[model samples]
Target chain A: MTKRPRYFNLEPIMNPKSIAVIGASDNPDKIGHVILANNVASGFRGAIYPININASGTIMGYTAYKSILDVKEKVDLAVVAVPAEVVPKVVEECGRAGVRGIIVVSGGFSEVGRKDLQDKVTRSGMKYNIPIIGPNCLGVTDSYSKIDTLFLPAAKIDKPVVGGVSFASQSGAVGSSVLDMIDNEGFGLARFISYGNAAVVDEVDILNYLADDEKTKVIVFYIEGVQRGKEFIEAAKRAALKKPIVVSKGGMTDEGAKAAHSHTAALAGSHQAYEAVFKQFGFIMADDIQELLNLSKIFETQPLPKGRRIAILTNGGGTGVLATDALYEHGLQIAEMSKKTVESLRKVMPPIVNVRLPLDMAGDAEKTRFEAALAAFEADPKIDAIIAIALFQTPGADENVAAKLVEYGTKMRKPMVVVSPGGSYTKRQRQIIEKGGVPVYESPGEAAKALAALASYAEYRDSHVKKSR
Target chain B: MALVEYFEAERLLKKYKIRSVESRYVKSAEEAEKFSAGGRIVLKAVSGKALHKSKSGLVVAGISGGEIGKAYSALERRAAKYRPYRILAQKMVHGGIEIIIGGSEDVQFGKMILLGLGGIYVEAFKDFALRVCPINMEEALSMIRQLRSRKIIAPDRASEKMVAELILKAARMYQGGRMKELDLNPIIIHDGTYDAVDIRMIK
Candidate 1:
């Protein structure tokens, strides 16, 4: 329990009641048209006011206005998709109109060596006390509020169903791709924000806003660079007390730094410094986009484990060994089953099966055997979490095994996962288990890493609570 | 960039309460011999002009009282190109865990401190961990815990606490914001405390 500060009011940005889409266009090819169409088609319940320079005409079947000032109704947010040069003046006008939030989709700011224009936008935002998302960004998409501002087309990229994970991405490229992937992964997403250039609103504001957001269970960031190091650290540290924060930072190498500079006009800070801040502050670092997805799946669904001890129930013996190694590498321990539990599992399972930490139930173990082993693991107080390496390729392992894992996921209080690797058959079974809310990792190593991340966060939250005391 | 004089670096380290091994400045070989009377001695060349002390063969160790004069002359001839050079002599710290702690400016993050394995291993292994500066004691301990070779320093938990406290104390000098870099390498770890054997700074 850390209380969020009153500063950086960004409530209206994510859940605005009435939104005005500036530069609304009839031409479908224009980005403004795409953004306007996204709002028109989405589940947004708010009034969509299309603002074009003409002021008298209609666009997207909605009444178009010459300017936001001319609109009589109260506008909670304005999405500006005009040219770069006119951005500052448009934002100033939005401020005068009493717009609570503004998302500028127009580019040609600092990313293109146009800091002068970017500074003007920053000044206007400050003058009006209006929080502008970006002069060059994809803006925000809140699934709960149905407020869609990202310029990406709705048909081409399916938006993820509403869930608890909220994201703040500095790069629109990464943001859009992840949005697409999250949909494919079938996990729900609460909000998605792409704050490009970060001229007025930065990563810090996003972190602070999401920290207190009840809908967001986890906050993830895709950062190529950050605007303020100290402020970012302080905000993130405050946020992590409530929920886990996962970070995937690009531009670690010298060459990558240069590319990042040109991409976002950001001074990609020293990698080691950022690395240290994340580690000491209890922020989970994802090595790549895949890992980011892996961590997000677990944090989004599972409860924090009681301890670091994890038990593995695998159909394949080899996968169990690999998972154990991965567990050790991540500073997690293999849970030793209690003597009584092991004895019961030994009697129920085949004679060839080894009743130990991994408790490998040979390749042909049926769904019943899997369930029996899991029951023992769940009953044993020593096992804080469980990983089931249910390879679908085996004869005895079928859809029943996937269903068993899903049933465990639904019924058990402890965190659990499934690691299934194969061709199309295994992939289908994994998707089935995943859709049922049990995270199914492709490899045993991924399963271990996800569990490790959960444990680290649990450890951090416990320590942080103790520290406050 | 020029390296700060050794005495000034030590003085700043002292002003901020960063522990360091006691050493006396010596200008000539005879004075260096007198300082090494008790035990084995470690010698370091101190000069703004001396960019690479070890590469220039300006540092020598394990010199007895009789051998101090000969070692000092050889160092003097080796460092002849560096016209304005001085020497500091201190009794050797014996075999202790060699570690490095540093605080410097990161272009984007402002001030940051790094802790790592020292001596030749630091370059060969690069086993290091760092955090933004003005960190608390808890953060300093966390930094040590993140190290890959933390077991070497964990022979005594009290020793880890000492190094963690040392990091906090040394951070004050860096907080002054004048130093471009402050590197205390080969800080010998003892039971409850440690000795900073080499202090290097660039201002």
Candidate 2:
């Protein structure tokens, strides 16, 4: 039997006491130098190192260790930011120095198609029994602890309140974009991981870990492909029933499919086969990044839908029609308005406004119209969730919109999604919406998808809960 | 793929330990009548490309000595037009469930085994489960349990152990990789005994 490394808890690296940067450079422009600077900038409480040879005693005020072997302190994690050729040697020294974890941020090992070097790295890591994060990767971060060793240039703000959404991405760029969008939406992130090249660890291992993570209520993955098909299916099956595991598989297109095969050396299964597997295992598959984040926000905040019925509230007829089209395309229904809801809507809606299923407020541009529309839908028993497209047309309309909707939404015990389509809206308006604690999406598709995803989760949650009961 | 000749297909299935109907090739009705004296017989045109011999009136079931000549004459005329130009007479095996098992090599996933609700509805219902090859007994059992027609394995209908064994044997044959395709229809399960009423194996 091939002996594999025992799975160890990796929470420390994300919340480490000290981190030593191997191959730290004096050149601020390079990855090695920038990583050390980021650690200082991000307020990492741990120790930072700028390991250099024949240089000044300090690179950036931290004592320069010639190598990890020379450092006296016990290093919790080592950030290797050197050339691929020299990474193995650096890893060997770190292993000898008793480093618990190493994040090899450098590329050109496996990504560049060098198996010999990859083998050496893998074998040494196994021999020393160290959990190597990546030979090519963006390192992990715990937003809750403010521990970010990621290579991204500009990082987002500190995390929000502890919630259960953790992100795992195949591409670091995509992951950074997701974090920025999540931050913009004012959603708290539990953890963000980019498994670059996945030379040592894979998506399945991270999913298995996240399945039991107390802070992780949901797992959102951006998977390009899987190494083992059966193992992946089994892991997805087990995890989906336990927690809401959403995936946005890149390479859905033909060109992307070619890139996926070369990048991961995985047989990207037929698209139909993938859909079947996803359905069988109850995994929510998203089409794009926007949808992934949109679903993430909804699953993070609201209760799952008990049924497919939806109530759409809008300010313009054209926008309402567009939302209707989207609902039909997405397999959602425009809820039939209850008599009381229609009666209440008619009181505020202009005679010209179509106040049937959508509860259109027309171009009245009145805050009361908006509030009345939301309230009427909130009172409707048939509606499971609400999608409100409030694009700022009339002045003073955008203000207090999100707050008012949030208040009514909380009262009704349903998610009220707000989205602002294209056009330059002031930052203040956006903040007003986000500050109201209603998740703001930038597109109608995002809001609609959020509701759909929430409903999917709710179905799973309800069944599991009922089963337990 | 052409339909496999019944007798020729059975020879291949016997290599894989799959049971088939007791059959024999006969040139004339006299040989068929003498061979099937103890019981009724089924006279079928032995053409590999022929499908639905009964629908074409090329097959006659429950034939006795008096009707054997008539049935054989009709089958021989059908066989003349049929590409194979042969006739097969066999005892009509009865009892058991009609579960279908087949194997095909999927391009991306390699060898795959398909177990489905059997009989003509196999294609109509299209209800099946697929698994990549070199499957263990546990994996085979999992596939069988996952099928939509899995209720066929319930005790009221068929013996569970017997059905499980039939599936496991097919999986082993797939693992052996000597054959390209194997389909067993109406794998009769009576009490606990099972036999393949009709089988087709192709490479």
Candidate 3:
């Protein structure tokens, strides 16, 4: 558990070989007890030690040590759940024991106007050359590696299944709610980190770490403010070059900036400055929470689009019109179908079908209609992406149509998204499509925005490369 | 909060390869007429307190060499309460769209360059684009594209290229940390080239 200079791997901090639960209590009301119980239930692939100063016997069926220094085995990570006033002493003891990393989940630090205590904790970590996550944060959750340090009970915030998208936030409430919705989104997770107050390990470190994380294919962030602007700009540039980074900045308005400053003691930069940086560095920015999640899932599921040209195929005529407006609004072009593609589709589709850019297959379209239109659009070299509006509530759309959409939308050559918003029947069908590795948005606007973001990222990478072809 | 004198600001802009309107500090009314050189010139009162000099009618424009004395006296009278620092006579430039280019150090980020529709409508419209500096050509072009009223300038490839060049120069001028802010407002974009009509810097 020794610290290495420059080449120190953060792997042990997140996916450690062993951990210790400081302040592990028997009372359910205490946060320490809930965190210890979660470690047991999360099936973390490591040894767990319980440390309590007052405990005389085993706590939670594991041997209890009075202090972290008294623990025999090497403590790779220490999850500190104690009073804010006592955190500095406990952390100093953990530092003396050569703990590799620490996550202080207690609140009542700088957010409550106690900057002196937070500074003491920071100083102790610096003296020992050890990294710390927070003094007021929920810590991190790695779904695949199974290192769950979130203090909330398991029943309250359901864990998302394992996948490629990784999320990092600056607030616990937002992180916990997003984690619960990750499962509902039918998108799995790689890691979810909440560095509230960010006493030591700030957003720049997390950005650099995930840039090299092999399990993470796309990174999402919910940041209230950024203090270290130069380092953040450089780190964000490095990470975005490797994978798509979708960011949702919380404090944009004057009112929100004031609240953010009080919430995390963050010095929120001007909204114009943040917007300029996000655009210049190629980080896909979202307007709201839903757009943030919507933009992220598409990058994880689909291949990069070639250009801004998109072809819309829909079972409903009105949905086709809406998709057109949205595509233009998002700066996407309605692709001009090739003559051969149009001729081929006309031979197969009924006369009721309008064989054009917005290929409305009508309300009575079945599985074969979707299959034909998707195949035509997929084969057209002019079309860079496809948007399939599959209304399962329609009379002719059934389970077979759902299965066919999954097949077409999941193709690796061209990027495709399905817009299917409905009641229970549609929701069940959406599950099937998402299960087969296709992303589904609820509305035409969302679907268009997702595809537009995908196309823009691809275009940026194409032009921003350093090497000449 | 002290402003760099107007002549010094123009010299700095010219040193960074940004073409700016020529002006001279006239200590007397006779010097004002001589600086005009029988062409259309503008008269302005210079002072650290005259931040919004143009808005306060401290500037009198399009006066020939014969009327330069009258314009200079009128500007001096309006700017007297502010304890005017100097009287300036500048070449009156016209015949192009106005663009406002600026550079300032942000609190979190370092030096950044800004571009917007210049003149009185600048504050009312607030249509602008900004980027951190040491900006490249592609970035400058992107900034130009972000302007909402870019079409109002009837922008062509030549004009856009010049604007981007002006932005790069602004970035260079604001570098080295000696100055705080650089504003080149109402830069007149003529057919061949552009002239920075007004230059203001703060330190």
Query: Which candidate wins on DockQ?
Result: 1
The positional error of residue B61 in candidate 2, measured at the CA in angstroms, is 19
Give candidate 2 misplaced runs (Cα > 4 Å).
Answer: A5-8, A53-56, A155-164, A180-188, A253-273, A337-355, A394-396, A409-412, A426-431, A434-437, A440-446, A464-469, B1-203
* iRMSD of all candidate structures: 8.5, 10.5, 8.7
Measured with C-alpha atoms, the lDDT of residue A112 in candidate 1 is: 92
Q: Quick one: ranking by DockQ, best first?
A: 1, 3, 2
In order, candidate lDDTs are 0.83, 0.70, 0.83
Q: Rank the candidates by TM-score, best first.
A: 3, 1, 2
Q: Provide the fnat value for model 1, as a fraction from 0 to 1.
A: 0.39
- Chain A TM-scores of each predicted structure, in the order given, are 0.94, 0.85, 0.94
Q: Candidate 3, TM-score vs. the true structure?
A: 0.94
Model 1, range A349-446, lDDT digits (tens) per residue? 98888788788899899989999998998899999999899888899998998898899986888999888889998888888888888887888888
Residue A325 alpha-carbon offset, candidate 1, angstroms: 1.9
Q: Cα miss at A177, model 2 (Å)?
A: 4.1
Output the better candidate (2/3) by TM-score.
Answer: 3
Candidate 1, residues B90-194, lDDT tens digits: the string is 778877888888776666677778777776677677787777777888878887887788889655678788888888887777778486777777788865668
Shares of reference contacts reproduced by the candidates, in order, are 0.39, 0.00, 0.31
